[model samples]
Target: MEDIGYGLLDRAMIHQITERWRHGGIGIIVLQLRHVNAASLEAVQLWESQQTRLFWRYRMENDYFFFLNRMKSDRQMKLILDSAITSLKKGLQAAAAESSVDERAKPPFTIGTASASPSGLGRSAETMIYHALRDATLSMLRLRMKEDETELPFGSGQAGARSEWSSSVGIGILAKAIPTFDLHAQVSSLAKLFESNTHVQGAVIVNQGRPVGLVMKEKMHQMLAGQFGLPLYWNRSVEKIMDDDSLVVDASIPVEQVAQLAMARDISRLYDVVTITRNGKLLGAASIRSILECITNLRTEEARTANPLTGLPGNAAIQREMKQRIESRQPFAVIYADLDYFKWYNDCFGFAQGDALIRYTAAVLQDVTGILGGRGDFIGHIGGDDFIILTGSSAEDADKLCRNMIWRFDGGIKSFYNGEDVAHVVDRSGNRIEQNGVSVSLSLVYCDGSEDITTEHISQAAARLKKQAKQLNGSVHVMGEVFEKHLGEGRV
Candidate 1:
C-alpha cells in the first residue's frame, strides 16, 4: 500500500490503525526494530513492515488525539487548522500553476489583436485560458467546501450577537450607573446653596419635579454684575438667573446629537455642561470633557432611550415626558408627528441617505419647536420617523408649528423623491414604487392642570387621535372635547 498522506485518512482507517497496534504489537516492533536492519532481506522486510504499521498507527492516534484535544483547547486547534489549511491551499495553487505552465507550452496558435509574434499570441491566449479554468475550478471547490458546524471560535457575528444580547439584558444599566437628582433640590442655585463650597461653580436646574435647565457660571456672573450696588448676589435665588434656554438633554437622547447641538451653539463657554433629565427631572450634568471621554458610552446608554441608528430619543423618552406632563397637570398638547412611510424611504435610499432624512427631520423639529425657546417645554426625537412636541402654548400655536414642519419638509421633496411627484411611481429596484411624500400626521391631546388625568390616559387618547389624523390624508387630529370629556368624567 502507498503512504497515504495525513489528509486522506478517514475514521475507518484510524480505527484500523488503532486495532492493528493493539493486536499486532506494532508499537513494540517499531521501538525495537532499529538494531535489526543492515540491508539483509529479512531485516529489510521486518523494517518495512514496522514502518508501514507505524505510519498508520501514527495517523490513527494523531487524528483522534487532535480531535479530542481541540475540544478543550479550541484556540490552539484553530491556530493549527488555520496554518494547515493555508499551507495546503498554497501548495495546491502552486501545483495548479505548474500544471498550467506545462499545458501552455503545447497550445494551439490563434491570430489575435497583439499578434506581433507567433509564440506571443499562443502563449498569451493559453495563459488566459489556463487562468480562467483555474479560477473556475477554485470557485467550484470553494462552493463545495463544507464548514464544520462545531467550529465558531470568534468573529463579528459572535461579537455582534453577544453585544445585542448584552444590551437587551442590560437595558437599564445607565439609569443605575448615574445618580438622579431630586427635581426640587436641583431647582436650587449652586451659587447660593454652595456659596461656601468654592469648588461648586454651577448647579443643574430642575422644574416641575424634573430636570429642565442649567444655572451656569456665566449666567451667575451676569446676574451678580447687575447687583453690584447690593450685597444680595449670594442671597439671590439661582432660579432668578437660571438660563431657561440652556441646552437640556434627556438621558435617552444620543450623545452624538447632544454633542452636535452643543457644538453648534458653542455651549462650552456659554454653558459647559449638558444636563440630563428624565420626564423633566434632572439626572446629572455631563460636561463636554466627560462626554468626549467616552462618546460610545453615552451613545450606548442613549440608544436604550433613543433610536440606535438615528440617535433620536425612542418611545421610552416620549413616555417619560408624557408622564411628567400628566403629573404636572399642565394644559399642554401632545402633538404626535410621524413621517409617512419612512421604511420605504430607508429601503429606497441607502442607510446613509436615511440618516440624512432623519437629520433633516430633526432640524424641522428643532425649527418648529423653537417656540419653547428657553422654557422646558419643547420637541423630542421619538426614534425612527416619529417626533413629539410638548408645549404649554396654545393649540393654534401648535397647529402653526406643525404646518411649518410639513412645509419645510415638503420643500425638500424634490431632492428626496427624485422629482417624481412624490406620490407618483418611480423605479425603486425593478418595480414601480410610489412614495407617500414627506408628510406629518399630528395628534393633539389637551390637558387642563385642574383635571384628574393620568399620563397613560393621555397617551392612549393621543394614540387614538393620531390614528384619526392618519385617516384624514395628511391632516391633524385634535382629540378636543372628547379627550377633555373623558377627563371630566373621571375616566382617567
Candidate 2:
C-alpha cells in the first residue's frame, strides 16, 4: 500500500497501481475533499487513513483521492461511501466543537462522490481516473451552489451536449454519453430508463473509463419479452447481457472512417451505437442513425465539390488547399497532369474505355504521389483527365516525381491500344493519328511561397505550361524556362 498512506504515490506508483487494479477487475470510487489544500500532504494522508480501510486510497490530483475496491453493485458502493462520509463528518464535527465558536459555524469536510466498476469500463486507467476526477469537480460545484437537493450524477455523462456542424465534420460532433451504466445494473432498471428516456436507444456500460459493453434498448427488451425472461435474468449483471464486441472508435477519427467501420458491422449490429474514445478513454457514444445522417450530408457536400470519377478532391477542395498553403507561406509545387491524345483516344476507344483509362491514370498518379509525397503533399482531381499534385518537395523532386509517373504510366497503358494503334495506323474513324499511342503530358508549376498565388492563377499558369508539353514529343514534362515566363521566375 506504499507505506499505507504515510508516503505519497508518485506518477510511477499511480500508473502501476491503476494498471494492476484495472486488470484485476476492481472498481474505483472518488471523493472530492474540499479542504485538501488547506493542510499539508501528510495531514491529508493522515486524515484519509482515518476514514476507511476497505480500499487502498491514492491521490490523483488536487483535492481528489480515489480508492480501489472489489467490483460491487452501485448500491453497495454507495453504502460503503456513506459510512466513510459519516466517519469524516464525525471527525470534523469533533474538531469544530473543540475549536472556538467561530470554527463551529463552518465544517472542514465536504465530499463529492462517484463510483464505477471494472465490469463496465475496461482497463483504461486514464478514462476511469478522468471520470472520477470530473465527478469530484461536479460534486464540489454542486455543493458550492447549495444544490444539496439536486441529484448528483454518477454514471455515463451529461444527457445533452450541443453539436457542431462543418464540412468534413468529425465523429466528435455527434458523440453522446446519454446513458451509461455499470455491469451490475439490473434489467428492470434499464427497462424503466429506456421507457422514460425515449430519446436514448442504448446505454454504454464501462469499467473504470474503458468500455466493456453496449446495451441497445430494443435488443434488451426483445430478449426480455421472451418466455419467462424477466424472472430469469432481471437481476443479472450487464456483462452477460451487453454487446461485448461493440464497435468502438477514437473520437478524433474523421466521420468518413467512422462510417466505414459502422457499416462493416453485421446487419443486426449495423445500427448499433459507436462508442468514441479519446486516447483510449471513453469520451462519448455516437449512434449509426446520427452517423448516417452526417454521412449523407457529407456525400451531398462531396457531390457538389468532389470529383465524381476518382472521388478525389475537386476544384473547390483544391482551391481551399491552395488557399491554405499560400496562407502558410510554405514553398509548395503543383504538378498539372493531362492525357495527351485523350480526345482521339475517347473518339476511337469509345467513352466507356476512355473512363477506364482516366481511372487508370488516377490510380497511377495516386500511387506515385503516395510514394513521393511528403507529409503535406496532396493529390486532387481537377476534373476530366486532368489532375493536380501538391507537394512540399522542391522543384527538382517534383520534376523527378512527374518523370516517374509518366514513365510508369506509358509502360502500364500498353493494354489500352491494339496492334494498329501501336503501329501508328488509322483509327476506326479513318483518322490517321501520330505514333503517340495515347501518351500523357505534365506541366510542373512552382510557387516559392513568396507569391500569393490563387488557384485560378495556378490553373492558368499550368495551362500555359501544358501547351509546352503538347509541343514536345510523346509523354513529356515541362518545368524549365518555357513555363517560368508565366510565373515571372525560373523554377530550379
Candidate 3:
C-alpha cells in the first residue's frame, strides 16, 4: 500500500530489501507511496475507473495500491499476481532441488558452479544448463555403449601352441603362478622374479594386491650399495625396501581419473604403467602408453561415458553395475554419498577452492575404499560431490564406511573454516549468513538375492534414507530390513 506512514516507507528499507531480492535473482519488488496529494489521488481514481488501459488499482479508504500496468482488471491483477508469485516460488524450489540433484550426481572430483560457462566458452545460463544436462545424459549413453563393447566370451577364444617360450614356463609355471612372497620376503627375491622372467621388465610392488610402490632394477641397485648391501640384499625383506610412493587406481575409477594422473607426468618422468585393483587385490596393470591409448579409444568409442570434470564413470556405469548385480543375483549394498552444504561451501570459497575440495573428497573416498574386501565391489563417480559405491557387504559395513568417510572429510572442512569465528554476519546487503560446518548425508541400501531390486527402486530407497539422514543434522541413514519394515507400515 502506497499510503502507509512516512517512517514505514523509508527509502533505506526499500533499497535494502530490493537489493537483497535482486541479488538472490528474485524479481518481485515492493514499494509504498505514502500521503498521496489530492490531485494525484484523483488522477489515480480516474485511471482505475476507466479500466481500459493495462493498469489495476485497489483502494483501502485513503490508501491505494497500484499493480503493474499490464494487468488491467482488479480480478485479472489478483490472478496474475497470484500466478506469478506461485511460479516464482515453484522456480526457486525447482532450482534448489536441481542443485541438490546435481551435487548428488557429480563425482567427488568435479566441482559445481552457478556460472554458465564451465569451460570459459562464454555461454549463456540457459545454454550452459542445457549443455551440462545434455553432457550428463550423453555420458550415460556412453556407459551403455561401453558395456555392449566389452562383451566377455563364455569361454577362452584362442589357445596358444606349445613353444619354447610357452613350454619352458610350463615345467615350473604352475608353481610360479601362485604368489610366494609374503610381506616379509626379501626385496631381492621379488627382484629375482624379473630377472628369472625376462619378459617382466620391472614389477610394481603390491601389498595385499594393492599397488603400494614399484621395485625396479634401478631402485633395487640403489638399495644394494655399500656395506649395508650384503645384509639387506641377502636377508632384508621386501617390506623394508619397497618404495611407498606408487599411485593406485580402484576398480570403479573412471577413465578420466587415470588420464589426469598420466597427463601430470612429462615424457621423461612418465610412469611405465598404472595398476588397477579392487579392495587391495591387484586386478592388472595397464602400461601408461596403453592407458593413454585406451582413453583415446574410449573417447572415440563412447565420448559420453566419462565425466568431463572428474573423469569418473557416469550414471551408465552405475546402472550397468546394478543390472549386473541383478543378473548375477548377488547380495550387494548401494551407497549414495552426498556432501552437505556444498552449495554454500562453494559460494563461500572461490571456485578454485571448490575444485580443490572436490578433488580432496575423491582422494578420501579412494583411500577408504581401497582397503575394503569382497569381489565385484565398485566405487563410481556419478558426476560434484555425489559418489556411488556398490559392494558385496551388509548394510552395517556400508554404514561404517560412510561414517569413516565423513570423519576423514571433517579435516578438510575444518581447514576451509580456517579459524573463522562461528558467528553470523551480514553481507553487504545485510542478509544474515553463517559459515558451513563439516557434514555429509549418506543413504545406504542393502539388497540380497531374495529381493527383487531395480535401479529405480534402489534410488527411491536411497532418496528416502537420505532425507532421513539429513533430518538428523546430516548423519548416516541405513536402509535395509529395518527401513523396509518401517516404510511398509508407513512410519517413515
Candidate 4:
C-alpha cells in the first residue's frame, strides 16, 4: 500500500506503470482478485464487506493526501502526464520498427509526438491518470484484435436479421476502393505505392483477407522523413506502423451515422480514413473529408426540397417518394389533406395566422401518423394548407388515420379562433355568416397492386377525391375506388 502511494508521486514510476499497463500486466489485477465462490456465499459476503470498508477508509485518508501532497505542481504534473502518453505512443511505434536498424537509430515513425499528446490543461492529476489508463486499455484492445486476426476465422458480424437502418443510404456511396496491402507487406513497397499514386491517401491493411488496420500516406511520409528515415522501417512489415485504431464500419451503415462516428474520434485520428466492410469482408475505404462533404450535400439538397412553412418534404420529394413506391409495386395509400374554407380564413385572420394554422395542421398529421403509422410511412407538405401522407398501411388503417386527423384538427382549430368566430360571425352591417371555422378534408386513394399506377395516377385520383370531400359538410374524408371496389369511406 505504501509502495503504491509512493509510485503515484514519482514521475519515473508513473511512466513505468503506463508502460506495464499498455503491455497488459497490471490491467487485470482487480479481475484476478475478483474470484468469488458462489458455493460459499457467506465467505464471499465477508470478503466483499472487508474490501468495501478498506476502500472507503483508504479513499478518505491516504487517497486524499496522496493527491494533495504532489511531488510536482499541477502544470508540471500535466506536462509529465502528457509526456508519458506521448512516450507510450512513440515507444510502441519505435519498438515495432526498430528491428531494421541498430539501437542507436531512432524509430522513423516517431515524428508525430505532438499529435499524440493529450490536452491535459485544467485537469487534476487523478483525471490525467484516468486518461492515461484509458489510452493504455484501448491500445491493449487493438493489440488483442491484431493477435486474434491470425487465430480467428473471418465471419460476418453476429448472426441475425439485418437492421432496417442498414437499408438506408449506404456508406459505400462515399467509399473508394483504394489500394489494399497485406499486413506483412514491406514498408518500402507501400512507400512506392503511395509514390506512384499521388491521389491515394491511405491503404487498408488486411490479415488473411480480414481488414485489420490503415496506413495513411501523410503519416507514413512523416514517419520515413525522420533522421534514420527509410533505413529504420524500409524492410519492416506495414503492420508495425499501421493504425489499428482506425474506424471500421459495415458498408450498409447509414452515412449520417458514419459521419457522427467519424467526428467523434480522437483529435489525432479525426482525419483518418474510415474502413468500410461488407459482411465482415473488406469492401472499401472513405476519407473523413469525403464523409463530411457527403453529409453537407445531403442536408443542402433536403433543405432545398423541404417545405419552408411546415418543414415537411415538398412536391419534389413527394413525387420521388410516390414514384419509388410505384416502381417497387408495393400496395400504398396516398391521403391528400386540404384545408376547407382556408381562403376565407386567410382573408379574415391574415397570413401569419394562416401560416400558424398550416403549421398546426402539420403537427396534428405528424401526431396521428406517429400513433398509427408503420415503418416507411411518409408525411409531406404540398403547399400552404395542403399536406400529403404516403403510407404502406392497409386501407383500414388509412381510414382510421384520416378519421383521427379530422377529430384532432377539429378539436385544435377551435383554439385558433374567437368564440364568436368558431360557429357564426356577424359582419358590421348586421349580416350573419355561417362560419364553420377551418377544417381538413382528407382524400384517400388506395392501390391494391392489380392495375398499373404512376405518381400522376395517384395525384389525379386524390385530386378528384379531394373535390368530392370539399363538396360535402365540415371535415369529411372520401375514398376513391380501385378495381371497382371501395377500400374505405368515412365522414366526420
Candidate topping lDDT: 2
Ranking by lDDT: 2, 4, 3, 1
Q: Model 2: C-alpha RMSD to truth?
A: 23.8
**TM-score, each model?**
0.37, 0.42, 0.37, 0.52
Question: Once superposed on the true structure, which residue ranges of model 4 sit more than 4 Å away at CA?
Answer: 1-173, 182-188, 191-199, 204-254, 257-284, 327-332, 370-377, 392-400, 424-435, 446-452, 479-485
lDDT tens per residue, model 3, 135-183: 3323433343343333323111110100011100111111112232456
**RMSD, candidate 3, Å:** 31.0
What's the ranking of the predictions by TM-score, best on top?
4, 2, 3, 1
As a whole number from 0 to 100, the lDDT of residue 378 in candidate 1 is: 46
279 in model 2: Cα distance from truth in Å? Answer: 25
> 1 or 2: which has the higher TM-score?
2
Please give, for residues 115-152, the per-residue lDDT of candidate 1 as tens digits: 01112344442233223223332232222211111122
lDDT of 1: 0.45
Most TM-score-accurate candidate: 4
Please give, for residues 376-478, the per-residue lDDT of candidate 2 as tens digits: 5777787889988878899879888988898789878888875454645344567675665777888888888786667777778788888777766578787
Candidate 4 displacement at residue 387 in angstroms: 1.2
* lDDT of residue 155 for candidate 4: 18
Clash number for candidate 2: 6
